[model samples]
Target: MQKRRRFKQTKTLGQRLAEEVTRLRDQARALPPGRSREMLLRKARQDETAIQIESWLRSPGLRAPT
Candidate 1:
């Protein structure tokens, strides 16, 4: 008999944020044109922008001020 090894699941902040952005976009797309849908889409855009900024900040190519 062999026991299966279980690995702990974890998500990084960037990954979690990216997932939220995806979920929001999906939900927004499923809804008809309305104020609520607009709000969700806007939120999704904001999250996506944040993720981009986070990636940029962590980029190895980025240089500090001289």
Candidate 2:
């Protein structure tokens, strides 16, 4: 039987997502305005949204839906 490979993440999800967003934005900025650039920007926006949601979830003000 093959064992699954295990690895530890050195960075938190928020950190990873933030890095990805930064990378995507930088790539998009380097490209000419077009579908590829738009797609990269879209992905960066999604990552930013994910970061926001993660922060909101971890915030002390978060409450269970009544």
Candidate 3:
């Protein structure tokens, strides 16, 4: 496994949301309308980040990470 960074500069709420949206859109564009990859390993991090963003948006008490 890759070692995680001990500390990193976090992005702003808007920036994170935008990045997620961008990644999802890119992934969508990379696929065909009627077909999809059997195992989409492409942009996995982006896909995960986008899902996290979606979940955050659904939580009423969620706050921007500090």
lDDT per prediction? 0.88, 0.93, 0.64
lDDT digits (tens) for residues 5-66 of candidate 3: 79664976556666765666677678776435323434555566776777778779989855
TM-score of each: 0.72, 0.86, 0.38
- Cα lDDT tens digits for candidate 1, 1-66: 999999765986689898999999999999999999999999988988888778778989886534
Clashes of 2: 0
- The global Cα lDDT (0 to 1) of model 2 is 0.93
Candidate with maximal lDDT: 2
Native-structure RMSD, model 1: 6.7
Candidate 2: residue 38 Cα off by (Å)? 0.3
Model 3: which residue pairs collide? none
Between candidates 2 and 3, the lDDT winner: 2
Off by over 4 Å in 1: 1-9, 61-66
Task: For candidate 2, list the clashing residue pairs, or say none.
Answer: none
Q: List all candidate RMSDs to the true structure.
A: 6.7, 2.6, 7.8
